[model samples]
Every structure is written in structure tokens, then in C-alpha cells.
Target: MSKFEQQLNQQLHDLAKEKAPQRDLWRGIELGIEHQHDTGTVPQNRHRRLAAVAASVALVVSLSWYGIQQTSVPATDHPTGQALVKALSNQHEQQKQALLVQYTDAPAMTENWEAQLAELDEAASAIKAALKEDPNNGALLRMLQQVHQQQITLIERVHAPQWQQI
Candidate 1:
């Protein structure tokens, strides 16, 4: 089609017409095998090397797991964590209810706004369940806060003025 493609095709065609190697390719391999047998030099067992690599990986993984377990804070260790989570949850609920009340008469820009809110609520419920198990988890706390913020944001966006969106 193009000049580059024509050149590529011509080169491939030329290579296809070239003669193959004249000598037997297996002769070199057979000589090497005979030489090794004469010298009594055996090839190293591949399984032993594979096993050593596997053992090293296993050791490193186990040590890393142990280190992580030792460093992480236990769920039940922090007595005030659950109280804090409950307080935050209560505040978020109140704020959400107030927001809904304020926007009760406003029509949402998107038809699926309620469905989105429901999904966020479900995510929040799951996070709360996880918090019950590991109350002191900082990452989970942050995720819960983010999800709550997102719910509030989504509500505000859907009810916001079209000019404000622009």
C-alpha cells in the first residue's frame, strides 16, 4: 500500500527465498552432550533451584505478614474508637436529614439521584459494619467520612442551579 509497507513486503519475500543452514544443527548439541558425559559434569537439578527460590519467597512473605500483624493496631485496643464513630455517624445522619428537608421541594437534575443516594447509603452501612469489627482502623474511618461527604455533595449537585454548575 504505502512505501514502507512495500519495502517490508519485498524484504520478507527476499528472506523467504534464501537458503537455510547447510550443516546439521543437532551436531553441535550432540558434541556438547558427549563432552559433558566424558568430563562427568552433570547438569544442575532444576527442581532444587526452584525449591530454593520458592523457600526464599515463602520466608519473605511470612516475615512480612508477621511484621504487619505486629505493627497494626488491634481493633479492641482503642476504647474510644466506637464512641467516636457513633458520634460522627449521628452527626452525618442529622446533616443529611436537614439537607433533604431543605431541598424537599426542589426537583433533582438527574432522574437516578435517589438510586445513587441509596447506593451511597448501602456503602455507608457496610462501612459501619466493618467499623464495628475494627473500630480503630484509620483507613476505614477516612473511607466512611469520604462516602458521607460524597452523599452530601451528590445531593447538593443535583439540586443546584444550572448556572452554578457551569
Candidate 2:
């Protein structure tokens, strides 16, 4: 290497050393943040409070819904399954009425929902006839109850607002 080139390289290395800041830049950033808070432009505490209230309202609403669902069915059980029949019938009727009200003017997603509901009702009727012949038949009783539940579910699915395309 030439002496002049070596000296130039040494000078570049000396100039490449780290330069210190003349003032604390962190203090400027801290003050800017503090000014925003003081001016109420950024409500740091308000955000937390709003988030907490939303969470609390969501929790309360979910709990209330759960409680309502839990209380819908009575705990008393009839030995002959009469209470079960009564409960299923009442629930089915209520759901049917609600669906009718909701879908009286609403179009169904499926074209054959009425036929499907009719088929389920027919099955329920056949099961009910068998149940009348042998009221103690657990299998027949369960089948009838299942049919009722299916009808309710089908009605709910067809009449749900979310299912409406518009």
C-alpha cells in the first residue's frame, strides 16, 4: 500500500467514531406525550374505562341469556313421561309461533322448507300414535321428543334473519 493511501484510510477510520447527542432526545419525546395527555387530545384512562364497560356489558348479557335458557325447562319429571310430552309440545308451539311471525313476509332460503317441516310433523304424529299404544315405551317416547326438537330446529333455521338474502 502507498503511504498516502494508508494515511487517508487512517483519517477515514478516525472520522467514523460514534458522535454523542448534544441533548437528551428522550426528554423531548416524553414531554410531547405528556402534552398530549394534558391537552385531553389522548384520553389514556378513558380508553381503558370504555373497554372495561364493554367487557362487563358483554359478560352480563351472556350470563342473562344463559340463565333464561336454563329456566325454560322445568326440573320436575313425570314417571309416565307426561311432563316430557307437555314440555316438548309447549316448546314446539312457542317456536312455531315465533317462526310464523318472523317469516310471514320473509322468503325462505330453502324452497322445500315447508315440505321438510311437514315430513318431520308426520313422523312425530306416527311416533305419537305408537306412544299412545305403549305410553311406557322409552324408545318411542324419545323418538317423538326428538322429532319435535327437530321441527323446532328446522323452523328456527329457516326463519332466522341472517338466512334472509336481502
lDDT of all predictions, in order shown? 0.88, 0.79
List model 1 lDDT by residue over 36-80, tens digit each.
Answer: 877656644555677899999999999999889867978566445
Which stretches of model 2 miss by more than 4 angstroms? 1-87, 161-166
TM-score of 1: 0.50
lDDT of 1: 0.88
* Prediction 2 TM-score vs. true: 0.45
Report the lDDT of model 1 for residue 118: 97
**Collision count of model 1:** 0
The number of the candidate with the highest TM-score is: 1
Summing lDDT over every window of 10 consecutive residues in candidate 1, give the lowest-scoring window: 39-48
What clash count goes with each model?
Answer: 0, 0
Provide the lDDT at 51 for model 1: 83
User: Cα deviation in Å at residue 22, candidate 2?
Assistant: 65
